[model samples]
Target: MKLKVDYKKCEKAGECYYNHNALFERTDNGFPKILVEDLTTDALRHEAAEAIEVCPTGAITIEE
Candidate 1:
């Protein structure tokens, strides 16, 4: 599985990057920059889920 973010649905809330920095980074414009595309481990998958749940706009999802 991989973590995917829908840019059109994102509102730059910073929740993904702020809480899940291992998988994301903050762009200069405050948008989230995905640091990992692949959910290579159970840890990563769990982290991605947390990020997705925290996203207010529900922009993050798991791409299987």
Candidate 2:
């Protein structure tokens, strides 16, 4: 239910956090960091989906 990131493919574009700051954060190095606990609700999941879609590197995913 949490979000995961594949660092190998991440380019630190800051898109995920930019699209959904409540669920993710931009680290000092520019990588996206998960900020929420669990995406148990539909609204949160939908927001996560939008954030995932904005990832140009396709590095973020749902950790079920």
Candidate 3:
């Protein structure tokens, strides 16, 4: 699986950080930091999905 974050639509709520900091974080100005440029593990994919869920702007997408 693969994950993609749309920086344009990101609202920077940081819910992904609360759920899984390994995959996402907030920038100094308060935007989600795209941590894993390339994710090949199931664990990382799961966390990415979690990030997608909480994004207020629906900025994240997962591809299988």
Candidate 4:
């Protein structure tokens, strides 16, 4: 699976970080920091979907 966060639409609510710190984090400016790109692991796929669901700003998307 492929994952990408739209920084332009992101509100930096930190839901992604709260759920998976190992996969996501917040920058010093409060924006989301995606640790992995183009994830192939099952764990990462689940986590990325979670992040997309939890993102309040609708900034996350998954690509197959």
Which scores higher on TM-score, 2 or 3?
2
TM-score versus the correct structure, for each prediction: 0.97, 0.90, 0.77, 0.86
lDDT of each: 0.94, 0.88, 0.76, 0.83
For every model shown, the clashing-pair count is: 0, 0, 0, 0
Write down the TM-score for model 3: 0.77
Model 3 residue 14 lDDT score: 74
The runs of at least 3 residues in candidate 2 whose Cα sits more than 4 Å from the true structure, single-residue gaps closed, are: none
Q: Cα deviation in Å at residue 5, candidate 2? A: 1.0
In candidate 4, where is summed lDDT lowest over 10 consecutive residues?
17-26
Candidate 4 error regions (>4 Å): none
Best-performing candidate as measured by lDDT = 1
**26 in model 2: Cα distance from truth in Å?**
0.8
Over 1-64, each residue of candidate 4 has an lDDT whose tens digit, in order, gives 7778888998888888888787788889888787887788888888888888888999988877
lDDT score of residue 13 within candidate 3: 72
Q: What is the lDDT of candidate 2?
A: 0.88
- Cα TM-score of candidate 2: 0.90
